[model samples]
Target: MGEKLNISPGELRASAHAADTITKDLGRPLSKALEDIAAAADSLRHWSVGPQLKATGEGWGSALGKLRGRVGEHADGLRMVAAGHDVNEENVLNRFKGW
Candidate 1:
């Protein structure tokens, strides 16, 4: 006999909640860290001896911001999908906890 995978509405809702939690947790710290890094980078850029170094620092900071910017978007998208699932699943909270 072959085993089949069983999923319940409650499980789906729980998974969506978890996704939302993870997104918030990750986004909160990332924003703070990025701010601190940007401030330090700005200070370093200001004190640099040559224009080249200042420009490099500015370029790197811009790149960092651009790259990390997508994290929040991706997290938000994940959370949006999860929230949709929560609403779409009927009687989600009452579903069985199938293993």
Candidate 2:
């Protein structure tokens, strides 16, 4: 087979850092917005058209919630990728030694 692949975790770690930054940027403001929306929705619940307003607020909150969740997941995924690459290299070395 070709020479054993040489992999470095530096780049992966950098990517993970970038992902984490993005997650914070997206999730922080969104969390604040969600809280505001919840308060607004609660206030609107007493009006005649309150149901519609509440529903709209809920929809917006839901979408933002999903986005924040996804951003968090993405960051987690990147961090996992960064950490996993080192583990993968160790596994390969162990298998190669066994062989």
Candidate 3:
């Protein structure tokens, strides 16, 4: 009566790897770009709107940092899930080896 649940460890691992790649590929470059923009804004300190622009860039950087952290956490969670499932499956198979 219960629905069957199917999990593919390989797929989970692949997804985790993709997440990690995304974090690595995008995170550093984007963070660096934001810092550069903030630095550029700082150069305009004499202008009335320069401080606002700098603040905006810093805020975006902070938000991106949080997002990167969250993505990393998700990747870790996915890997853990995949490994756990593999172990569980192995344990189940071992229990039935004598049958």
Candidate 4:
């Protein structure tokens, strides 16, 4: 098998710092937007036209689903990038001891 490449601690720290910043920036805006959308959806129940109200609710649901997908992608990217730094020779050897 080929030798494993090692990631320096400094590089890991930098990558983690960037991810933290990005998560904070994105999380706040997405949370606020989702809250506003949910409030709007709740208010739709007060509409007089039943079909129109239901349509509005469905639109909100679809929008929320898209927002969730975006958030999930960002979160997964952060995790994957962070995982790249979560390694070392000792840990790798320990994990693959039988190999």
On lDDT, the leading prediction is: 3
Worst 10 residues of 2 by lDDT: 1-10
Query: Residue 54 CA error for candidate 3 (Å)?
Result: 0.8
- In model 3, what are the clashing residue pairs, if there are any? none
> In model 4, which regions exceed 4 Å deviation?
1-4, 46-99
Ranked by TM-score, the better of candidates 1 and 2 is 2
Error of 2 at 75 (Å): 1.9
Error of 2 at 84 (Å): 2.7
RMSD of each: 7.5, 5.2, 2.2, 7.4
Task: Return the clash pairs for model 4, or none.
Answer: none
Q: Arrange candidates by lDDT, highest first: which order?
A: 3, 2, 4, 1
**Which lDDT tens digits does candidate 3 get at residues 1-99?**
233556588988999999999889986699689978888898998997889899988898889889988998999999999999989999999999989
Clashing pairs in 2: none
Provide TM-scores for the models: 0.45, 0.55, 0.87, 0.42
lDDT of 2 by residue, 4-80 (tens): 55445786667667867876787777777767867776787787766776777779878877876777777677678
lDDT of 4 by residue, 53-98 (tens): 5566568656866765665566566566556656555688889999
Better of 2 and 3 by lDDT: 3
TM-score of 4: 0.42
lDDT of each: 0.59, 0.74, 0.88, 0.62
